[model samples]
Target: MSRTAVYNLPARWLHWAIFGLIALEFAIAWTMPDIHRDTRPVGLVAWHLGLGTFILSLMLLRLLWRGVSGVPDPHPGPAWQDRIARLTHALLYAGFIALPLLGWANASARGWTVHWAGWVPLPALAAHGAAWARPLGDVHQIVAYALLGLIALHVLAAAHHHFIVRDGVLRRMWSSSR
Candidate 1:
């Protein structure tokens, strides 16, 4: 099969969709609890849950497609550069897996249904218990913070490639290169 040119269309959609969702998810995760109940935290929390479900579902599909279509070639760079890319991606994949599970667990522990949007309900991965969910939420928050930091680094590296290295790296994933 032909290797995709930079990102193929599906990859592009997945990238932006996940990027936006993750950013919004992080924002809600950090600030909701401190706000008063009369405020809008409930809606924000629900939106976060809905988006997290979307992220997790699309991620599974993306992984399947990645397995079938194969990954684009790693950008050519120094040895340390390649390792950084690999490690960053591993962390991302781990967060993708962890975030939703933690959210679901948190909801379940708090006696809320694991609802996917206002439609299609998801069953709890574990029985209801604060003992289980609170710490999972804590870990989820930590991982989300880590994801934010890594994303900043990822963006800087991409920018460095575009401006400093003057390579095709950013164009492959950012613009139409065909």
Candidate 2:
């Protein structure tokens, strides 16, 4: 088998950073009380929103970097498996962008302005108490759950490549240099 080139340092860092941020977002969400419009955001809720914004920004940057740097060569595998892998990656990227927009829309519908670190208020995406708030919130939750499943599948696939297949596919993303 041929050796696979590892991702560049910036790519590796962005990938890991986004992964850590997503974990932090989940932690904040699970621990914090539900934020309501009437109540000012404090503690975990504030951290959740702030971290989410940061994640979104980083994701955008990652996408830009990906576009400029391009991906490593495709892992040699069954054609079907390669297609499946591509689809999974696309969904993950879309989720990174979609989930936050959904959350932002939900917040806007609730008449709340998202502030990053207790300052730098973000613009509202919808009117206060908009008819779409509840629906958007519900969709956001559903997508989040789906994203969690996708992440699990992603990790499982990587493990399969590393352990069972004994392919260097996993190492491509694991290392910062070729």
Model 2 Cα lDDT, one tens digit per residue, 1-178: 4433778778888888899989989888889886555755667777877888778888889999999877777877899999989999999999989998898888788777898544689988888888876589789879989999999999999999889989777668878543
**Model 2 Cα displacement at 11 (Å)?**
1.0
**Deviation in angstroms for 58 in model 2?**
0.7
Over the stretch 43-155, how does candidate 1's per-residue lDDT look in tens digits? 66777777787788888887777777677777777999999988987788777977788878876766666667535789877676668665776787777777789889999
CA lDDT of each candidate? 0.75, 0.83
Evaluated against the true structure, the overall lDDT of model 2 is: 0.83
> How well does each candidate superpose onto the true structure, as a TM-score?
0.87, 0.91
For candidate 1, the TM-score is 0.87
Q: Give the clashing residue pairs of candidate 2, or none.
A: none
Please list the residue runs of candidate 1 whose C-alpha ends up more than 4 Å from where it truly belongs after superposition: 1-4, 30-42
Deviation of model 2 at 122, angstroms: 1.3
True-structure Cα RMSD, model 2: 2.7
